[model samples]
Target chain A: MDSSQRQLNRSYLLRGLTDGIPIGLVYLAVSFSIGLSARTIGMTGIQGFFMSLTTIASAGEYAGLQVMASNGTMLEMIILTVVTDIRYVLMGCAFSQRFAPNVSLLNRIGTGALITDEIFALQISKSGYIKPFYSYGAALVAVPLWAIGTYLGIIVGNIIPEFLVSALSVSLYGMFIGIIVPPARDNKAIAICIGASFILSWAAEKFLSMLSTGTRIVILIVVIASAISLLFPVADEPAKEAAQNE
Target chain B: MNRITLYIIVMAATTLLVRVIPVLLIRKEIKNRFIKSFLFYVPYVTLAVMTFPTIIECTKSPIAGAAALVGGILAALKKINMFIVAIICCVIVLVLEFVL
Candidate 1:
């Protein structure tokens, strides 16, 4: 009986690892460009490594790097970090429903730190109820793989030719689009929101010279999400309940 | 700590707090439906916002980047694996860069 329980835990854990490996590989490249960009803006490989450990956010780090490179104040950096990371608040709330019923507070904090866009997407798409072990299995693979990529990005970015780095940098955006498309295809609200954000982000950046990228996104997400939720409050409630009870 | 080190610490702390505080405070499962669906779509939207415009800026040329974006959308629409989608888009960027 004990062995059977162990086997059950082991199988879920393995399932999680399988779920995480692809995400880890993408992190390896995406954050490599992050490490490259961080190095370009006067940070060391070690700093990039530690920063990736903490943030694991490609865009937030870019925003932070912008503040640093521009000689922006600490106040600016702090605000930028908060503004860019605002989505995590949403992701965290969604993740709350996923933890094993008896999950500890420490485990919550640990898993929270590891929840990036990739990890959240992978875990939420997971069928059936999830255990703490499953999240740990995914985190165990993803977080370190991201850190390694950052370290290599900082260390090896200098030695690599400039042209190839630009090419690799483009891969991160492809990965971002990749993550969202499958889910968006099935959900119209999501698809519309994706379309709105994409068009608005592009327009705001190219035409609205006065608005910064962070502010533009803050406005776009708030406006689009609020607008959609107001229009369609009943869209996913039943599904949410089903997921929670599952 | 010096200013740069302090800078690093602050950025890290703010991002970590954004992630951890919500999870810590909302220990019970939230029952609000609007909030749930709102959170559900945030990842897709935020990620989308990050991708466009910036994607073009990531590549050497706008045309190459646009090509890569279309390829990425295709790979995704096809329901390919995440890593393969990324790889296909990367290859598109490389080939387009070479061609253009």
Candidate 2:
């Protein structure tokens, strides 16, 4: 590529990294709890941090920690991780189309490593063609932040008293509510979907105690989502309306 | 490899594969109706599943955890910033933990 082209790609990477900062910070907070919990379950700091560094899948990691802590089998944990993270397959497909046709294979893999829920939403929401460099920039900023955050959680959690730490962990649940509530408030369909998941999850856990946690959650999500979508499929976002207005 | 080692390796590899396959293959937003609709609802459902029952268990006391969760939902509903909402949840839990 020409010097100007390379410069432009550099700028894209930088911009993506800038956008990634908030996401990384939030991830650090959530993963902090994961680190602490992993420690509670007997994993060393390095082991927990390495897991965070590689996967960056919050729910899957947390689920894995819980399973491991409970003397669950390796097969159980791995199956749970894959089940909880199956959404990444969909996210990956959506993002694959976003990259420019000519972006190299290695760049694709590097950028793809960072395609979490928030990153995918942010990248897809952008107006222009996506440069692979932009994703690389974002990943570089977010990934290390997540790894360090997990490590710090382990270190700090070891020092803090459990009650205070438990108090801090409340914020994790708060974060999830913060994410789901706003969107649910505006959209009736999303509200009902959340409600259904809540009821089913509680019921499933209570009645289907025989089923594994991972299996219960997977069934809850897929059954509720599929049933809701079949009964009432929400219309797609209005991409065309905005284009006309513009 | 031991079970823990094997578990970590499998988790990392499969999760990586899940994130890689679509980016390497699909060129656009998926057009399949079943997959599209299913994907659309996955986030909300997953979050809800994570939140309920578990949220009740996050704090030192059920009262504190419930209070913080209600506080968070109300705060977010009022269009409060998430960072602030998180802080509010922590503060509510801390204070309630002291009282309860």
Best by TM-score: 1
Residue range A222-245, candidate 2, lDDT tens digits = 799898878667556422321221
Fraction of true contacts retained by every candidate, in order, equals: 0.73, 0.67
Question: What is the C-alpha DockQ of each candidate?
Answer: 0.62, 0.52
Highest DockQ model number: 1
After superposition, the stretches of candidate 1 with alpha carbons farther than 4 Å from their true spots are A1-22, A30-44, A66-76, A97-101, A127-135, A153-157, A235-246, B1-3
Best candidate (score: lDDT): 1
> Which lDDT tens digits does candidate 1 get at residues A134-199?
667777788788888888988988565556756677665777776778766766667787888888
User: How does candidate 2 score on lDDT?
Assistant: 0.73
